[model samples]
Each structure stands twice: as C-alpha cells, then as structure tokens.
Target: MTIWEMLAVFAAGIGAGTINTIVGSGTLITFPVLLATGLPPVTATVSNALGLIPGSVSGAIGYRAELAGQRPRVLRLAVAAAIGGLCGAVLLTVLPPTAFETIVPVLVALALVLVVLQPRITRAVQRRRDRDGRTATPGDRGGPLLFAGLLLASVYGGYFTAAQGIVYLSLMGILLDDTLQRLNAAKNVLAAVVNSVAALFFVFAAHFDWTAVALIAVGSTIGGQLGARIGRRLPPQVLRVLIVVIGSAAILQLLTR
Candidate 1:
C-alpha cells in the first residue's frame, strides 16, 4: 500500500478500535473500508478479524478492575467460548456464506432496536433492583445461559462480526447481575476470547491481508488506549448516548454495505 492509503487505512483502524472499545461495532468501519479498497469480502473479513484481536485484548486488560473477583467464572466461561469459537470458525469455512448473509439485515435491525431501548430497559431494571432493597450481587450471573448465548453469539461473530457487543450485552442481562458496567466488563473479555481464538484459526488456515491487518492493529491499539481513558472519565449517561448513536450508525452502514 502507498503511504497515503496506509494513512487512510490506519485512521479507519483508529476509528474502528475506538468504536469497538466503546460499542463493539468496529468491524463495521474496518470491513467496509477494506472492501472499498478492493480486498475480497472474505479476505477483508478474515484480515479485519485478525486486526481486531489486539483491540479486544487491550479492552479486556483495560477492564481488569471489574475482572478481579471473576477469575474462576471467566475461566469457566472461557472454556465454553473457546470451544464455541472453534466450532463457529469451522462452520465459517464450510457453510455457504449466503446462509449467514441473509441474517445480516435482521441482526442489524435488532442491534439498532437494542441501541434505542437499552437505556429504558436498564432504568427499569435499576428501579426493580432498588425496590428489592438488596445490594446487587455480581455472582448471580447465569453461567449456563451465558455459555449458551456465547455459543450463539460466536456463530454470528464467526460468520460476520458487526455490533456483536450488543448481542453480548443483551445476553449478559439475561443471566448476569444488575450492574451495567460489570456486565460491560464481562462482555469485553468474552468478546476478546471469541475473536482471538477465531483469528488464530484464520492465521493458520486462511490467507490474510497482512498490510491491512498491521495498519489496523497499530491504529486500533492506540485507539483502545484512548477509549479506556475515556471510559474511566466519562459519565454513564454520556457513554450510553455515544454507544447508542455510534452503534446505530454502524449497524445501518453494515446493512447497506
């Protein structure tokens, strides 16, 4: 790639990483930019997956505080996620891409709806928690349901990972505690394992656009740092609004692309 093109791609990577760290739609940005640059769809998909792997790692690392008491839980769930991710990656290699393509519109629509309603839903849940007059226990997280949901989410991630964070959040609510921030932390680590294991598969078995991956990696790693800083400083309301707006835009762009 020429220097200018490299700059553009790397900039997109930074944007993608920031978005991924904030809302989990980084793939929507990076994939289209790569496809527009003339990379084949599958190649872009694979390379973008590889590129985002580091961002996921950094995001998880950035959530170390929330993860302090959840090591055993995270490890147990990680086993399920690793196996599911491997299965999903194998399916990605075998299934007709069209089968999964048909779900993109529906997935995008759901993600948009989630973005719109999550705040209201969270508020209602918070009210319920307050009324119950009990301190929220993080241990109440539903491990089995979470494991199952991770399997389903991984299938989608393996096929086409765009706005997957919403899916994880959606599922987290079902089986986890009432705290949004804690759920968000779990979402990050789970996503990291999913992307990393699948990227490992593509690295060993598939052709990758290393130039694009490298550019995205460098930019996204920097973006991840900024995102973590912002996450530390921002209010929950500000974060919610930003996540919804960007997530909505990302899903819309993915459908059109």
Candidate 2:
C-alpha cells in the first residue's frame, strides 16, 4: 500500500477504536477504508477483524473500573459470544457475501432506533423494577433472554463487524440494570470476545493484509483509551445521540456501498 493509504487506515483505526470503546460501531469506520485501499471484501473483513483485536482489548481494559463487579455477567455472555462468533465465522467462509448484505442494513436501522429510544427503555425498566419492589444488585444475572439476544448479536458481529456495539448497547441497556457506562464496558468485553474468536478462525483459514492489521492495532489501542476517557464523562443523552448518528451513518454506508 502507498504511504498515504497506510496513513488513512491508521487514522480510521484510531477513530474506530475510539468509537468502539464509546459506542460499538468502529468497524464502520475502518472496513470501508480497507476496501478503498484495494483489499478484496473478504480479505478486508478478515484483516479488519484481526487488526481491531488489540483496540477492543485495550478498550476493555480502559473500562476495568466499570467491569469490576461484572465478572459473572461477562463470563456467561462470553460463552454465547464465542459460540455465535464461531458460527458466524464459519458462515463467512462458506457462504457468499451477498447472503448477509440484505439483512445487515435492517439490523443497523433497528439498532439506531433502539439507541434513540434507550432513555425510555431505561425508564420503563426502572418502573418495572420498582413495581416489583426489586432493587438492582451488582450481581444481577441477565438470564436466558439476554443470552439469546447476545448470541444473535455476536453472530452478526462475526459476520459483518459493523455497528455490533450499538446492538449490544441496546440489548444491555434494556435487559441489564446498570449505568450506561458500565453496560458499555461490558459491551467492549463481549465485542472483543466475538472479534477475537472470529479472528482466531480467520488467522488460520483466511488471507489478510498484515500491514493493515498492524496499523489498526496500534491506532485503535490509542483510540480505545481516548474513547474510554471521553465516553465515561459524557451524559447519557449525549452518548445516545452520538450512537444514533453513528449508527445512521453505518446504515447509509452499507446501503450506498
């Protein structure tokens, strides 16, 4: 790749890592850059997935404070994410790319809607909990419904890798009783699990552009830390708006390209 192209990928990686940490749509930033840089679709997807692993891990670490009491939650969700990710990776290798194209845009749109309505969803959950005279404890387990939703989201993350964070946030916001920042921290861990599991398969079975991977790894790691710092300070409404806007952009990108 040209130096300029490498620079662009690196820049995208930074933005992606930041966004992934804050909200969950970083792939939307980096994947198109890879495509523009001349990688074929599948190769770009594989390389992008591998490249973002470090950023995801870094983002998770950056949110370690929020993650402190969520070990059981993370562990349970990780299982679903790992299995779903493996299934999605296998599908990516075996099925035609067009197989998922039609559905992805719809998923992005749905995620956007959920993000926009998150405040209402949270309020409703709060009311329901109050009616039941239940107080939210730190050890709240998400149960089977959340597991199913997360598994489906992980499958989507494995296959497409765009806007999966928004999906996770939407599910977690409604299903899990916690602050958005805490749920976001959990989102990063789950996303990392899905990406890491898929990356493991891609590393063995798929071709990649290592330069792209390296550039993104470095850039996204930095971005992840930056995002965690900024994201933790933003008001919930502002963060939700940002997520909706980015999710809309992801939908537009997918529909147009």
Candidate 3:
C-alpha cells in the first residue's frame, strides 16, 4: 500500500478501537478502510480480526473496575461465546459470503430496536415480577434465555464482527438488572473472546496481510485506552444514545456496502 493508504488504515484502526470500546461496531470503520487499501474481503476480515485483539483486551482491562465480582457470570457466558465463535469461524470457511450478507443488516437493525426499547422492557418485566411478589437479586444470572441469545450473537460476532456489541448490550440490558456500564464492560470482554477465537481459526484457515495487521494492532491499542477514558465518563442515557447512533451507522454502511 501507498503511504497515504497505510496512514488511512492506521487512522481507521484508532477510530474503530475507540468506537468498539465505546459501542461495539468498530469493525465498520476498519473493514472498509482495509478494503479501500486494496485487501480482499476475506483477507481484510482476517487481518482486522487479528489486529484488533490488543484493542479488545485493552478495552476490557480498562473496564476492570466494573468487572469486579462478575467473574462467575462472565465465565459462564464466555463458554457459550467460545462455542459459538468456533462455529461461526468454521462457517466462514464453508459458507458463501452471501449467506450472512442479507441477514446481518437485519440483525443489527433488530438489535438497535431492542436497545431503544430495553428500558421500557426492563420496567415492564420488573412490574410483572412485582405483581408476582418476586424480585430480582444481584445473584440473578439472566437464565437460559440470555445464554442462548449471547451464544447466537457470539456466532455472528465470529462470522462478521461488525456490530455484535450492540446485540450483546441489548440482550444484557433487558435481561440483566445491572447498570449499562457494567454490561458494556461485559460486552468488551465477550467481544474480545469472540475476536480472539475467530482470529485463531483464521490463522490456519485464511490469508492475511501482515502490514495491515501491524498497523491496526498498534493503532487500536492506543485508541482502546483513549476510549475507556471517554466511555466510562458518559452518563447512562448518553451511552445508550451513542450505541444507538453508532449502531445505525453500522446498519447503513452494511446495507450500502
């Protein structure tokens, strides 16, 4: 790649790392930039996945305070994420690209709607619980439904990796009675797991550009730290709005591309 193209990819990586840390659609930024730099779709995808690992880890580490006391929950959900990520990675090798092309946008759109309605949904469910003389405790682990939904989202994350964060946040927000910041912290860890698993699979199954990987890795690592600072400071309402806006952009880009 030319110097300018290289710089663009690096910049995109920073943007993606920041956004991914904040809202989970960082792939939308890095993928197109990689494409513009002349990498093939699969190559770009593989390289991007490989490169973003540091950013994901960094983001997760940045949220370490919020992760306190959630070890059992994160671990349980992680097992499902790992299984689903492996399946999605395998599908990437066998399935045609078009298999997820149409469905992906639909999934993202649905996730956005879920995010928007999550507050109301949570309230309604709480009311039902109240009527039944029941209450949610901190020990609640979101049950089997959340597990299933997270598994599915992880599969998608492993496959395409665009806006899987939004889907995760939506599911957790509605099902888990916790602050959004905590959920966002979980989302980062889950995203990291999916990306790491898929990237490992791609190492044996796919081609990649080392230059692209290096650029993104370094840039995203830097952005991850920056994102943590910005994201943690945002109020819950602002954070939700940010997720919605970025998710919408992800949808539009997916549809147009």
Candidate 4:
C-alpha cells in the first residue's frame, strides 16, 4: 500500500472506533476504506475484526464508571455472545468468498434500517412496557428474549461487525431498565467479546493482512478514548444522522463495486 492508502485506512479506523464507541457500525467506515485499499472482502472483514479488538476494550474501559453494578448482567449476556460469535466465525470460514460478498450489502442495508429505526423502537418498547405494567430494574438480566436477541446479534457481529453495536443497544433499551450510557458500556463489553472471539477463530482459519490489522488497531485505540469523551455529550440525533450517512455510503460502494 502507498503511504496515502495507509493513512486513509488509519483514519477510517479512528472514525470506526469512535463511532462504534458511540453507536456501533464502525465497520461501515473501516470496511469500505479497506476495500478501497484493494483488500479482498473476506480478508478485509477478518482484519477489521482482529484490528478493532483494542478499540472495543478501550471503549469498555472508558465506560468503567457506567459499568458499575452491572457485572452479573454483563457476564450472563456475555456467555450468549461468546457462543453466537463462535458460530458466526465458523460460518464465515465455511462459506465461500462469494457468499460473503453477496450477503454483505444486504446485511449493511438491514443494519442501516435498524439504526434508523432505533429511536422509534425504544419509544415503542417503553410504551408497551408501560401498558403491560412491566418494569425493568437495574438488576434485571433482560430475560430469555433479550438473551436470544443478543445471541443473534452477536452472530452477525462475528460474521461482519458493522452496526452490531446498534443492534445491541436497541435490544437492551427495549428489555433492560438502564440509562443509555450504562447500556452503551455493556454494548462495548459485548462487542469486545464478539470481536475477540471471532478474531481468535480467524487466526486459525482465515487469511489476514497484518499491516491492515496493525494500522487499524493503533488508530482505533486512540479513537476509543476520543469516543468516550464525546459520546455522552453528543446529541443522539447527530450520531444517528452520522451513522445513516456513512452507512448509506458504504452500501452504495458495496453495490457499485
């Protein structure tokens, strides 16, 4: 890669890390940049998953204060995430490259819809809970439905990442009684687990570009810190709009390519 190309990938990494920390879908930024750099689709996906590990962990650490008193809930959900992530990682390796290429745009489109609808979904869930006379406590682990939804999301995260965080946040918002920041903190932890597990699987089963990994890791690590600082303060609508614009761009690129 040229120096310029390397810089672009690094910058994308930073954007992805920050966005992932804020609302998820960092892959929409990094994946397209990696593709533009001429990396193959599967290689880009594997490398992106491996590279974002540090950033995910950093984001979680930055949210340590919000994570307080959420240990049991986080750990319980983590088991489901780990299991589903492993399954998704296996699916990636078992399928041919063409399958990944064909499915990615569809997945990205679905992710964008979820991102766009997240606010409405939250409000609807809240209303339903109120109507049903159901209340969520901080200690609530979100029951079986939440567990099942998270498992599916983790599977998708393991496969392609992208807006995995948004899926997580939406599910938690509906099922758990917690502040957005606290749910975001938990999202980071789940993302970290899914990425780490999938990356580990790729290490033994798939091809990787170590240069891409290194560049993204360093850049995302820095972005993670930046995200934590601004995420809470940033308006939700702004983040949603940003994600929609970038995600739409990614979808267009994938289809046009």
Tell me the RMSD of model 2 versus the true structure: 1.2
Deviation in Å, model 1, residue 208 alpha carbon: 0.7
lDDT of 1 by residue, 1-257 (tens): 77887888899888877777766778877887888788887788888888888887787777677676777667777776777777777777777756777776577567556655766765676688799985556776565767887777777876677777777776665556545566667777877888888889988877789999999988888877666666656665676677667666865675665
Using Cα atoms with residue i matched to residue i, what is each candidate's TM-score against the true structure?
0.87, 0.96, 0.97, 0.86
Q: How many clashes in each candidate?
A: 1, 0, 0, 0
What's the alpha carbon RMSD for model 4? 2.6
Q: How accurate is candidate 4 locally (lDDT)?
A: 0.86
Model 2: residue 46 alpha-carbon error in angstroms: 0.1
Between candidates 1 and 2, which one is better according to lDDT?
Answer: 2
Give me the displacement of residue 33 in model 3, in angstroms.
Answer: 0.7
State the lDDT of candidate 2 residue by residue for 30-131, as single tens digits.
Answer: 988999999999999999999999999999999999999899999999999999898889889999988988899898898788777777887897898899
Candidate order, lDDT descending? 3, 2, 4, 1
> What are the lDDT figures for the candidates, one per model?
0.74, 0.90, 0.91, 0.86
User: Which has the greatest TM-score?
Assistant: 3
| Residue-level lDDT tens digits of model 4 in 42-134 | 999999999999999988988888899999999999998998899889988888756655766776677667767767776787788899998
Q: Assess the local accuracy of residue 99 in candidate 1 as a C-alpha lDDT between 0 and 100.
A: 70
Return the TM-score for candidate 3, rounded to 2 decimals: 0.97
